[model samples]
Target: MLVLSLSTVAFLGLAQLADASGSPSTGHRRRTAGGGQAMNLVRSAPNSNEWSTQQWGHWAKTQKSSLEAKYGGAGASGTGVQKRATGTNYMTNQNGDSSYFGSLAIGTPPVSYNVILDTGSADLWLAGSDCTTGCSGVATFDPSSSSTFRNESSPFSITYGSGQAAGFLSQDVVQMAGFEVQNQIFAVCEQVSGGLLTAPVSGLLGLAFQTIASSRAPPFWETLVTEGAWDEPVMAFQLTRYLNVSGVQTLEPGGSFSMGFANSSLYTGDIDYVNLPVTGSYWVLPITSISVQNQSISPPSGQQAYAAIDTGTTLVGGPSSYIAQIFQQIPGSAPGTGDFESYYTYPCDTDVTVALSFGGRTWSISPADFRLARLTQRECLGAFFEIDSGGSSAPSWIVGDTFLKNVYSVFRYSPASVGFANLSAVALAQNGDASGAVPSATIGSSAARVSATGSMLPKAHRSAGIKIGCGLLYATSASLLITIAVAGVHSVLL
Candidate 1:
């Protein structure tokens, strides 16, 4: 299956969600980034605790269309399952696989602009200095003002699941986290769909490999690493938790984006390195198996299952067949009605446990991280949707933030592998869980149809993603979803 990826700007990693635990690999040693430098990520967008039926339905619509545009349409919607312990949230921190925000300077003299670091797609784009559209109040870049800015003849345009962006290509120095990449190619987007560019965040810093790059230039992070800025070509993240719990929540506490090493303070125990397929550009890993509670889901004969670890993707999507299988095991779960075609809804209080393995170990997602939103007091949306990618070499699953916040994630380039570990008890203590006791559903009513509004994701947003193996780039809507932020170490299976 030549499966592509779908993503939000800040997503990915594993825990009990799939190798999100205490698996120790001797060769996997941890180190601090060169110069002890760490890239600080700011929390820019505010989260919406309110997710009405209309919003859920709209999410299903845009997400389904996004998938169909590439992986073909999915079957009828399936049921839902969940066990979170918190309130409503979108993909921004608070442990619901939310968007991550940070600042990086581009152009010769260096002008800092807020950007979202994404791992799903490969492109670095920012708002042009021109006033208009999405670039409104947010900071914009002026090509003429920078002495080192180089112009390219190529016109730049990218269409996402919800909106679109058009601009031109340019080259300049991109410096972030104390590391600088000279003459890095990026997009200076002039026109953007509304709601895409909000205050504090003006562009996307895609961390995916160059093969998928729309501008066809080397990625900023990769360039810095290969250029000998660091001995290890590794980038790791610990997204802050803002979901349920008591008292005031600090927006950016505990959440960090780092390069060349893992933060020991954020996670506990040793990290395990999972081997990835060398044949692909995006991060693709094999899944040993999946299960709902105690029931194991075996793929059809000759079928190979791979999960795309995308930090930029906000939601977790998989084959309809598998999603259906997952919900069938959870009682009181059903497909959404009306415009909610690809999403599933279930009793908010069901103690449903979903787990996945990648040959070496199995991991699980906390119930809080599994629940996307509440359509009603009794029924809520499941974070995992259906993307129906049923062919060979394609990714059967796109693992995004919903599963990422449960564990500390590490993406390394040299060996070309991904790793995960349990969040330290201290880190977990500060973050709250999304799986609160939402009113339990009365089976029948839980399956009722819900209304919809517009796409929750924004223009050129990389929040919810589905990346194809090779082709043109398609965009996804971006929004904030909050659930409980639970991080813990899993006992080694040995």
Candidate 2:
């Protein structure tokens, strides 16, 4: 599921689709802002989001840094009363699916700030007034100025694959999206290195569980759900698409990030719910099997191997062996050389399709998503990459925005689970124009491109809940419930 920060989850192992499986556990940093120009070629896309296939990768890299800190904790008591409010909260994505930012206010008067809505990690961190390295373009928070600020004095830090941030823990009246949490313990950076984050974003807001919070405190969103700030304990994301639209590199409306309830208008049909351990660390669920063009691939040990759904990630990665097996089934596919050593490339015109199943139900990904970037007139790089989720006990795959763009995603609490529903027709309206994506003029012609958006999908295997249930509202008898939607497109469309 999720670090998918959008979030990552460990897989225990898996049996056949017939067996209801469970079990297993396990495991970015900010980058300075500044990106290359996007290609402007207009081409057909499968889903609502349009990615930079020209980048030669999946929208899966941002969340990789935060995975190192495997901390766990429980929710602390809320500091103030609940503020039942709703308004338009916006997130910008100029670098394709690279990162997403939303409005978050802290302190008594609430100094508004922008943060990444990462479902991959669990701690809420932002640039502090005293921050050093890599603090160029982001707004900084001054703990001294906030009336509700409390100095915990405990040194706080999170290490990434290449960088780290050092600061102290502080509690403050924190507000985000539509809800606010009081005395929320968050990180205030004094020194940050390894090129953690760029401007246009102050920091990241983890939407995962409290179990993996680096601050060892309940994440801001979980606090809202745990205290019944809203009706249902759920947070959903409908990340739209766009890439370097109109030469603008930042502040473009990306999609919707909802809390408490799921937005019905954003999706269609029943929200196929994938159950997760309520006390689990990440928003992860089990995948019975994965297939390419109807060809099947399973976890090596036959155990429950999970796919962490991370929004911060740019590309999707899996065990090398399984990845190799997958490409072997695709004709003209081969190992890419240098720079792309672990990647695979296939015929530029190949309309490849990949399908995955949870609880016996299957959903297929669009072909435009499969082919990451074009290498020549006839060859292209694949979006799927090879990543070892550390050890065998960890997730075998990390599912990022690449796969999420094909469906509407929901992460629920209480009877913990994740929901993946098909997109509404309205949402898929611009599939050909790449919807949210604005291609740069450099992408050449669509004549050399490939897209399997119109390819036939594998028959969906039916499970009881597979085709049953009322669209993201699966028996909301949890004593509480609420619904929210930002704007549409230029605003929050969910």
Candidate 3:
């Protein structure tokens, strides 16, 4: 079946950054741009071909398990914010399920490809001209077509939680918006397998540090920073949500991303900043505590843990025991009946306050965001799931899009840190419509723009924030194992 792998977290053992030949730009250059450069982020309509089957849910589960085994539970390690340069921001397009993509041009004349602007992993890869098998709808990058393409001697291979890609490393001119980075190093895949074949993307551009990159090359943003492309050294994300418009629930492409500086208009309150520790090649944040409805929920181990913020992850994953503890408080919450053994379904409109504290401040998620969908007349599935990373001591949470859509986030570099602010009133329209009722008019008067930005490869998971229909898509079948991972804090959707 065709699937949208989108952004899956695939964890590679942490390593030192590799040196690249004839680099795009040196890091010594100083940037001068002063204001935030904003890019339009569009959300694509869901694909029926993908959602109609149970494959996505099963794949997500598998990917999630993979992540626990790779970097969660016991093996998960600590994680980078490097000095950034003045860079041009590019527009992002949301694809099926967990995928948010953008366009970039490569080669001499510049051939554009629709790629995932993932902050989870730190490698850039696309189908090369030689990929004839399983590469049907993707845009392939050809070295022969560019005058500036430079071939590297090193062979490259990247493994996601559910798929794999292998090829040779090469360098060329990479372009975003109107900006260009000369001799940008990237991987050109001659072969791809598993869930990646079905993903609705041509390639992936990882935004993390070089430690986790498969090709070991500095990310495109790093190259931009080295070239002194920004007035500031930051990126921000204003992830949009599913809106009900004119009595129809629509997932519109309405989010924005900014580079170099923050867009004050996208947020309502002050930006709360926190230091980021690059423990294991990820933007890992220390969690002070977790509370449900203002009451603290203790984990099975009663130990404090950290959370890795990942854009590539679809769902918010927690330890199995902690997840059970959190959901136990909800009346009528019970085990799911299908391939989703790792998930639970609770009563519709259940009132519960879920919050995570990072850097001493707590950010609460709306109750409305918890409901995945109605299972029966009064039952609704939840967005949270129980995942066991064999080594319980590893970071216990993979905070994904479910929580991200509710806030405006900034990813700062040089001395890596993460910042959060309350989303503007306009961006909160989806949260305000708690009933999930489709409205008669369009929502939001102005475009919702924000910035701070920053990977993993796994079989991608579905976002819990999107509404699901109780149809043939979720029928119970034989037991299917679910798992996940990403390169740095690589996580899966459940």
Candidate 4:
């Protein structure tokens, strides 16, 4: 099926600055040597059946058309909004369906709010009391209820594939995992429309650099580093996936987020670090090659080859022409019918190996991760899809979680680099099984019930059982009940 995206326009202006400096802006602080915290990252949409390939196909088509119209030009030098992951994770219900979610706290007394930890956009926002559309059935934040709330009076607005949010800037105490940052900057959405109400999600927590942040404020992770919350200056993610005894695809609990430090225990071997361009937005990287089973495919050259490493997006998207080459290699794969022209279908059991090359290293994606879903018992959709790049101004690809899941990833703010390592047995658990020993839940206990639209914010604290050694507070939670409410597809499926 197709995919949707969150688009940003500011990254265009920042690319030039980065090209000259050989590095991104150095305003961010370096992590203390060997000091950092860890947090568990959960699937934003825990209920997977709430989404459909058909629905995703429709969303992808609409998003492509929107991009073409918005950025199409000859030799357009400005950075066009490629794909905004919108900072969402998905999970599934019974029968192998999926959605992903995470938890955070806001305001005084630390009211818990469920959020999608997105690496796409760089903003943190939640629905406020003033939101009229797509605000029902979900939790909302009331400024009056927060003791630390402060209004900046600056208006804010954001656009996504299926919806839009408009609100005002505000400041309050924000706590993620367990680390608390007082007077953190965020947005209060007063109005929302389109597909936001489809799922049970409170809001999105952007994990990208502050350059692309709408508030132009330091994102939560950056602030955490600046404050020396951890012993190291790195944030690591270990995403887990599994094939259950019933052959049902499921997300395991091994997924985690480590702040201020990269846990060597989670990954095997050395982390090959790569320079991520300071695009003033997403973690943009250069691509040297792409192939499937040793068959190389040529991606769009020049500006198009700069790919964005986004965890918010569910699919790997790029120009339709390039995607066609990859799809052609899959047996039984053919053009999708009706609404999903950009998508392709293949046999569910097809054995395929997709490899992506960057920074002189090739990372491979197995058939299990590349296969999006089983349309029937025999037909399946591929996770890699075509995204119109408006000729050439857009990015060559938006590397989503489909690729990120296979590796233990580290996103560093200062020097702006992205690193990847092979997921080890210690990091992903035995054979991708989550039934082993449970880590001690590190979430702190705090009680304050605010509005819950699609999912309730659990008042209990959780952790992943990682010790900071430096005696710093770790944000890794061992037990976090996350309910991801995706708007567009959820509305259609539910």
**Tens digit of per-residue lDDT, candidate 2, span 400-456:** 666877888888887888889998875466332233432111101111111101111
Ranking of all candidate structures by their lDDT, best first: 1, 4, 3, 2
Per-model TM against the reference: 0.74, 0.72, 0.73, 0.72
Off by over 4 Å in 1: 1-4, 7-35, 43-48, 67-97, 244-254, 299-304, 390-394, 433-494
**Model 3 segments beyond 4 Å from truth?**
1-36, 45-63, 66-97, 197-200, 243-251, 299-304, 392-394, 429-494
In order, the Cα lDDT scores of the candidates are: 0.51, 0.49, 0.49, 0.50
Query: Of 1 and 3, which scores higher on lDDT?
Result: 1
**TM-score for model 1?**
0.74
Error of 1 at 339 (Å): 2.6
Compared with the true structure, model 4 gives a TM-score of: 0.72
- Residue-level lDDT of model 4, residues 24-134, one tens digit each, is 112221122233223434332222233356554544454333323212211101111221111111121111113233456677655655444556555577878777876
lDDT of 4 at 44: 23
User: In model 3, which range of ten residues has the least summed lDDT?
Assistant: 467-476
Ranking by TM-score: 1, 3, 4, 2
For residues 189-256, could you state the per-residue lDDT of candidate 3 as single tens digits?
77765334322345656666665555546677665554445556677777665421222222234355
lDDT of 1 at 5: 43
Per-residue lDDT over 286-354 for candidate 1, one digit per residue giving the tens place of the 0 to 100 score: 777788877898752233476767655556777787788888888999987777766788898886778
Against the true structure, whose lDDT is highest?
A: 1
Overlapping backbone residue pairs in candidate 1 total 59
